[model samples]
Target: MKIRNLRLLPLLGLTSLISLNAAAVTVEHKPTDQIIIKFDNANVEGNSQARTLSTRLNKKLAFVRKTSQGSYVFRLPSRENFSSVKAYLKVLKAISGIKYAEADQMMFAINDLAVPPTEGIVGTKKPIYDLQWHYFEPVGGMNADGAWNQLDSSDSVVNVAVLDTGITAHPDLDANVIGGTDMITAQSISNDGDGRDADPSDPGDWVSRGECYLGSKASNSSWHGTHVSGTISAFTNNSAGVAGVGYNKINIVPVRILGKCGGYTSDIADAIVWAATGEDNPNKAQVINMSIGGAGSCNATYQQAIDTAVAAGTTIVVAAGNSDDDAGNYTPASCNNVISVASTNRAGGRAYYSNYGDVVDLAAPGGETSTGARNGVLSTLNEGTTVPAAPTYAYYQGTSMAAPHVAAVAGLLYVKKPSVTPTEVKTILTSTARAFPDSCVQCGSGILDAGAAIAALDGSVTPTEPAAPSNFTAIAGAGTVTLNWSDQSTNETGFYIEKRRKFSNQWGTYRSVVRAAADSTSYQDSVFGGTYQYRIRSQNSTGDSAWVVSGEVSVSRN
Candidate 1:
């Protein structure tokens, strides 16, 4: 029966193609200046009636096409007013057949924003605040001066989109905000008016409206969106609040999605699309930060929206999630196109609450809970109504805080190399990451190195050479033989060496030696004393190169 169904599909395809001739006619009639509207469900009976109603209201309304289910697509006049569009949708809603009508902006959800400490964590001895950054510095091929110097030319006018709760009116964020929109409703998402022009009243939290379920709610909260915005691009050298990642020159576009308990997937999707490419509205964002996510499979609508954003020249940075599960369980983070970031403690180990997986592109300083060691991330915070003093600076801890660091760095990179593609950005980030202990499998690329990423942007750093092996000799007096090798390089922080018996087709476990300088490289084996094969490679602050193999030596213990 399955085979027969497959056989009939081709015939059905042909029939559909044949009937598409008239459908193709509508494409030509679509207005170049008009925005596109797509209903969630076109098969609803009201949708068909809406199509007919559209024709009566204006001669400019022309039916464009229909989905396989018979939902109609119509093109509105280029000059149609916003009120008219709303009235038309209201008319359709009054009909029983229509489900939901939305402009093209309602498709993608924005990525949200991260660090921290203690035993049971990797790199526990190191300070959590700079662990990941320090780890990536050498591997990223950057020095202290190179890292700090790159910031000057990289953050002039970069734009980063904060897609979360609405950003409040804070002095630090005031200069950085470019523009934004509200996906939950047509009203402006900013606490201020349109285009970051004026301040608006913040409506704190809301009860679930049966439209979406975002889980629990916090009793006390300052505008999350505003705080996140300040962290990424707050005005630098400002006498008031804490400094931001990209200094004051970077621009932020806030797309509010999460409000009350949680946000709806539908609304979040729209924010993602609009934030990246400025659909329906005129605000085009260069980088999108999604600090919030839920458990569910990646939907087609969301994936399509992300693809559109990437094509339009935007870099999406997403949090791996606080659930502590592998990133595969998350949607946009797991999505192949975007950069998925995991959380690490200040000590440079995986954060307990951070999600892990091979899909994770990088790790940052996400704070941990067990050790009383707060990750202490510096960023802006809302002062609340009583305070009313612009956004204040504070230390936050979480994968949420860590994510913006990467986003801010990406923004700086964009400013330096505007021509860098999303893929190249990902490469620069991943390739320069620092490896962490016990993080070999979980951390994916390694800790994100801002300096290394920037240095590699223009190909200014020199690549490190691979380390050599030493002390090749067989044990005397026994059939079992032991061989030793010495470390041959200075910058080598770790050694990856492998050995295999002569007759065996596969090599034994590949050993990773850590923190070894040019002086140390020795391996002891208790196997046959005859001829044996060996291979060694060195990894350091720069990166690991190809393994240098030893000559096939013929030695006898007897």
Candidate 2:
């Protein structure tokens, strides 16, 4: 498969959500009053069996519809209070085949990063690169130009799914955009007179005050999805408004999840599965970008969707949120096995508006709009959605902006190393992350280094069996059981040891003894009590190898 061309590098950057004091701007994601339940024993054996299960579920619940294999969406009658929703879920979960249940939560767009005096879109006079200083100047830029030396171009088939407001028609982005989904359900919010459809067109997400139950002030359409698309593959070197990170041939699969006010977790989750599993995803996305998020925990609904995406061999990249708080408080960003990116300014300092915490994987350029769009991240945009006018380019900020930079980078790496996995993507991105030009507490491993990451892939895949450690020996002394092993693999960077208590000829569950660094072969395993047997395996920068036994040894509390 033809991947991104390393020859024609350097075209774009990412944006970030603005951070603020908890009290200044309240952006909380309230859950919808519905539940998503998944049946454990459900063997999607076929629709015939699922239809039977659905029939049985509809009898007890107010409404039951088969969403996925064993999953169903149900709601209680209005007469019953929402408090009973939990009770109903508990009872449903207790059913023989039922596994788990949770609320159909809500997710919102990264609040407006910058809204400089609203002006109708205008014409482009100067070349796009002249305005996109982030791609050339070092300042707060991500040094993207430097990385293009090693990687830049992309394959046409490698799709990066942009899960946000639907994309708009733009001179630079139109060709790269494949058809996508409109996940908005509410007609009022959709403004498209339909629930969910194939048309991923953005019909002005403008909202009135109090429209969201949050009493939020009215806001105009941000054209966010279009901007993100521009960053990923805005027909590069087109002598147009701006160049995309993934130049010519690279394509985008716009999965519209957020609309009018925002979207529900259920819809967003479904989009992830569809994009990842290639259900309706014609382009076959290798990466998914969710530049929008709201404050919330990692609910089961979001968890299952993400897990499914990962299992489908797709890398999920999410913004760390614009709220200047711990990203841990957000869903998907806090979800397991995702590349949760934080925003960094041109100086590489954590963008003040960017949410930070250990939850962040690495930092990306989520520009500070305060400096104006010229200084902020630049991408594609549209002045009107309904009639589709003012197709121009602009700069925006927020972690929302920053995520696409990484998403585009993931595409670059995939082109270079197709065998790489989601976990490996995270590892390469983080391990190769350059030190922040400035301090960024909880800003993750480091600022994203696109060139370093591509160079680091080095075509290395996890070994089937790195040579096991030899001279494996364990001895007990002075309340401590020290273990030593001889390294045999020249390529290994570390080792993992497991231990089990020897109960006569039988042994108990094997627990991890230690995960030692490459520099250390000897480990001081403190004895808790009794005799124990140990085994170990080697690990490389890629992943772990097969296990090796250390025989048996004894130690006593006395």
Candidate 3:
């Protein structure tokens, strides 16, 4: 394995900060009235299973199509009533031979405003270095400058797939971009007059007032894919507008999924599979950036797609979301086998609008334009209101901005260690992250330290016995006791949860009750009227840590 050459661009001008109000954009996402079902068997028997489920639920469910991940899409006879459709889903889930059933939820870009660039100095070609504080500031930046100095310069290019509104022709980014495809299946959403074509250029995602939903405000085209691609592979040391974290060694594969009023989960899922397995790709994408998402639990569609991609050795990185809520409430962010990134401000604190929770894998510089435009992440953009226009740069703020930073770093890691698995990449990234300089509760291990992550590829960062779980607690319920703890180790494969009943041995001898997956912070155990104490420890192939015990809690009712 070889490391790519990283050249740090010289800082030219004074830091120019612009204080601009972040746009108030309401990008609501909801189910598309279609249900996705996966049967135990997906052959002819699958159709039979669907028919049997329709008969059981007493609703006319029409087969729509098959998703790339092998899930079957079905449409109810009437879209007028969604309550009945949801009710049918409940019945469908209970039917045997059905693997899973869920509504095809919609997802949108997780970014806010896209304000045009502000003037830096009177006249100079280095406005970008002064404006892009999120990349080099010692307090809040990801320290890309330090990471660049550590690269070996003898490695091959790394491919990163950007799944978003698609890419536009930007002089700053086109050189590093490669062949890509549009994966949007809906004609209305594609907005380009066709569906699933070879062209991956963004056709603009602008929508009129109430176009997305009732009373929804009109929105301009975000050129989101362009911005994200710029963050990953913009030409470095070219005296260009802004510097990319990948140092121009990343080849972006744009897989367009989001369109007009956001995109469908089914489409995004298919895009993930395609981006991971497409044979036409010059090189397999080692890292995928999903800056687009919505409010929802991790459904089967996304889980299967993500699992498939990870199994194919692609490290997926997703935004934790911008709703300022727990990231566990979002889809791919909550989904297993991906790096979920939370947003941070220029002050190195949690951004005002970033999602936070145990699900988040780490934090990155997403930027907060509310403080100042210069504080926001600067990236390539198009100045068109509804279509492609003159190429430009802008300041944008959101988890959408943060994900590409991590993805770019992941690309660099892959360049250094070509054979590393997706899990290894995630572990290195989380373990190498530096502790947050400011308060950022539940923001995962720490803020992304690109220099540390890159340097970790030298085998200096070795895995050891994981630290003991912290904040262990037990709460008594009607007939069950819920055990909760915080994961403190980045390399742990899972958790060993042990519990002892008060009546059995005075809480003296504990037995392993459950072995939860890595990053699992909570578990529930049913009991028949007895007090119990719990303890948890992080486990890996290397070893396990000492147990962190919890107080006794009694479940009085059964």
Candidate 4:
């Protein structure tokens, strides 16, 4: 996933009526020949305004067409200047009777593609569970296993639309995939030789040197959409391959928008709108995942599409980009009404390349593979370089990988509470996320806690005690003992540790008690030399959990 730096094309004009304030973290708009504008009235003389502006600027603003959302598209006269579009946008937004105006910025697939191992059976053996550490590991994983326990076939069916390149049929993933639309309108970007079709198969987006823009390097096809889909709903319990966060119960709608050098904001926005109100698709996507983005302020086109989708009860999840800059500088991620997610690594910290800022809504295991492939997010992929090839699996690291974790969990939430609003879904995700175990500045409320999020949706379930701490160990020193264990619950208010004297044949009554604060994982004791054993349990407002006992340890007096 080499990021393609698109050079600015000639300025164009369009009008829109959706008045959205520009994102707070505004930057120079990305180069585009087209602009979307909204006039105060639906049936305004848009051509008249275009003519007057054209006269003032001495450049023709050729009208393209009106959008379903009432915005108008206009192409500007061809020019090589990068600032020409921004300069024209500044002028167009201020024109009388205009409600909103913005450049039709290009969006990109936010990822750093990792190479796959050369020698290994694809699906013969299960993907090592520990290799997929982002799912179950307490320190860095999303704890999706806990959510899987709570989810079953009885839960409502959730449709998740993955707006990415498209899907490559994989033995492990095709079972859950349904028909999707190809939303890329431009043939050059679509790479499929056609525009807007029902078949959503991915035509490889391999680029030659400098094909996207000056200095852009050549790269292979990422098969990014399949990997993302696998993360969301890859077949599980079939005795092979990796497990999905959705537990193989959710349906994946592959909405192909990104291809070649990535996709246009217009196509992505249209896909969002279609997911919301398209009558052609019966299984309306309850959740939409956009693991793609680009540098820019949130614009009216993105905001309006998100608003429309949110109004239709679809929870939109977007990548916070991978630029290591403010996510507010990216479209859709910075757009209002979408849950923007930042990337965390296997160390439970912000990924080195993850974008972060106030606009981020949550964090998830995006993975870091600089050290090894085992550390990255592994999912279904293809062996192709320029076209479709044999299906395979590979590890990919980026905010693109992180967004699906949240999106999959969102699908789980929707399954549990089918009538839940988009805002409520966002609330449960952010509110229930656990505090980051490592430093991740401005990485949203916290890393996503799947089990906690699923449980939070049910108000009637009785409160339960926190899980008992495990892996308890005691190391004895002269007149002292140090005890340590792992915290196993998210609701513990504190921990209660009790110790007993070890006699020749048995242990004495456990009387001595020590209280450790919430989230505590260790405690040291100063004691007279003696043989002893300790037991501990996590406690909360509900009750104390079952106790876990440690092995006996002997101490010597000084």
Candidate 5:
């Protein structure tokens, strides 16, 4: 996709806001203007200070709604209006306990719109597996082909909620999708003329540079959601345009949040919660793939929703952001409990644009578009910009493409171990990750390896008397604790392990053990409770996973 230089245009006055609508926007103070003030607190103006402030301002305020953050939305009625929105903010800031007051700002998607293939195909009998080198190349490629044979492709229990522009019609994906929902609230912006509804279809987020006061050039509709969905689950083996990380569309659940000018921060926060249905709610997504993000640290609204989803047993895999800056500055990725993924190129080196930092949990093949489509990541796409047109396949770049790879892998993990905890999934992935074949300092612990991850579950390959293991866990005992996932499936007999006391917040050496496991499902190690950690992996005629230790787990005794 080609990114046109974007210009930020702030909607400053009531006239500009009112000029936006085909009809007048019913605002708080001016029943006539469209501006809304995000107040920090509720209006019990009965309080002396509030009453005085309310009286001084002639126009009374009314409560709108409490936003995701504890802040309140209060409309200061237009008194033939006395000042500009800038002046109104100044007055509101003067009041005591007024956390913050400003107009609800607008945001847009930070994606570059590239031209689609001019000569499109209605359908194809063969999937261009070669076109998707990002999935097949060994250097940085995810071992998706091997994982497909092991995972339950059609298991209705697993579904990945794609929170992006929404998925549209494509022959390769139509059969795999169960259903979707539209979460866009701004009716005019949605272009669908509706607020929230059951239709989670992409309406093409193509925009003219002037629409949002963007100084960049106009663009064609980039089928962003469809491309993202294809990476996770485009119908495979149908001889279509491309293969997928998981199975076909059945694995994806489209949850639309982005529209005409990207989407609001508030809309995305709500979709995160909705994807994981609560009590009496039937929507149960095991993995939520937010291949979307923008600048800024996490806000309370995004923080709360992420916490709720994790508590509900959902694993969120997010893009580490395309900014190349520290992942710490991007949202949802920087948010707690998410498996943040950075992008790696064909040679296992970090993609030039992938954001990196302590927040990223792993790395995956997101591809580089500098050399054009053949070198970029290919997935599902559409020929239209504002409406649905012929189905096609195109290449795209960005950490946006990297996220679904990890999300689908998490989905595969769920199919293998339905009883696995979200914490365990993170541990196993970080543990079994294969070291990058090239230099990618701090991209994450390692690149994803599917074959090693499912080895224990399938009872296929076994481990030999070798080095250590990955994703090891312990069961507390009087003097001994047993390590987990050290399975001696079929070929080899046992495993070699290592231990450290996490002294001074640092791990010691593995010189203590020669061999720590055998022909059993787990290995037993003796220890006391100061916080012990271990590392091990299943090995065969082939080699075992990387020696990276799983994150520390606390052990205790009654």
Candidate 6:
């Protein structure tokens, strides 16, 4: 079952509802008390049969909850008894209502469970750098409804769990960051531990141990985790070095997975599970951002871990890789759950470095500077110094930077509408995006529309079902055909218009016009005249909107 992030408001006095102890406990060794069974849908006929089979299973084992659509929770007698459960499931398959079933393995928490600092005192300030050199720009989405104006009052604190290289304790991020653990070694991964007081020795960077033609050219301390964290929740609006997407209220839960070279797939999976629900952590985060990914097939271990995180009410936002190839090759991003984001340039076109496919959920502004591409984005960085002087701020380009924009927006949406599920948040962001030229088709759900998304929080313009485009009217004026028609009520962000000659029987090329809420119900088509056939389709946040056809509007050039 797919689970999206559900923002839950703070209860009046439930401050002590949960607590995480640092002392290691024998988690895996603990006797198994529950059994989670994931089944194949093809094995069962219908929901009625599934329910009947569930009842039969309950006769042999105590049932917990039907967590997802086809998954079930059961109380097991012991860990060793898991084999018996699997055997029974196989036997029951012949009983008409059963498919394959197996025992759910216990997963450890991936993060250190510790209470994060509450928003209050102002910390040391970092210095601001030149913006021209870097591509940093204020997020446009924050301008809607003056959301950024009330940065202090609104609970802008978002718990971003970074499953990447460990963050260095730089001056800019020191205050906002809590402690993290090293999943690779399964030991305390803090920069300073035991007697060692706050040592700034750990410079978090990617290193390649083996020799290759690429050599050490790629070997550089990116401080990637630190940079990504700052973008999402750096102490912004605080007269510091650089402003973050949000304000100072944001907190980061650092989960280190990537280190020298790329990290292991097993470690990544463990980190994701821990970050989302605090499965093994003492303190859990609300949102998890995965900026790193691999180009390979999806693994069963990772998929199961993702399922567990979603079941516990965590929203997983992943970056569409930088390969610039079909996104289907990427696993977790193409996985059933999680929100996959693509990169867009400032001109509102898809970045050449971004991966695209039917699986792409949405796109954001990933700055491009190498090829003279510009995308205005805002984020945080570390000033390498012990004394609080100027925090190192920079403008970075990558799907890495773009992912946080969506995460921050998600945080704001959570603050406004707490009931919205993760899936719903994905829906809102995708459906309400503003369509730019060469944008609708190349990018999944158009550009990220923070303003339109926030407007959706109050249910102003609700999304409708998908429908096809129909009917075409052509009005020739000023060397352009003014195309006008009634808007479709479902699955439409805008319309795609194409032109072709009647004799050739071949449709000329086409360009897309994003439908805006404020625009009148007409588009001026300037390129074509004489006899022509036109077709249009509706687009939504999920992908392309269905197409409705209007027979043909004959136009005579005046």
Best candidate (score: lDDT): 3
Off by over 4 Å in 6: 1-146, 149-156, 186-202, 206-218, 372-378, 382-391, 437-440, 460-558
TM-score of 6: 0.54
Stretches of candidate 1 exceeding 4 Å from the true structure? 1-146, 152-156, 186-202, 206-218, 280-283, 385-390, 437-441, 462-558
What local distance difference test score does each model get? 0.53, 0.69, 0.76, 0.75, 0.63, 0.51
Candidate 4's C-alpha runs over 4 A off are 1-30, 43-57, 60-62, 76-82, 94-97, 110-126, 460-558
Q: Per-residue lDDT for 170-191 in model 1, tens only?
A: 6656788876766553232222
Q: Per-residue lDDT of 34-120 in model 6, one digit per residue for the tens?
A: 444455653333345445655665534555444323455455444443355556556555564334344443221111222221211
TM-score of each: 0.57, 0.70, 0.75, 0.76, 0.67, 0.54
lDDT of 3 at 215: 64
RMSD of 3: 18.2
Q: Give one digit per residue, the lDDT tens place, for model 5 in 73-138.
A: 444453223236556668777767665554433333455534233322212322255456565444
Cα error, residue 70 of model 5, in Å, equals 7.3
lDDT of 3 at 106: 71
Superposed model 5: Cα runs more than 4 Å off: 1-108, 113-127, 152-156, 214-217, 248-250, 278-281, 456-558
Please state the error at residue 143 of candidate 4 in Å: 1.0
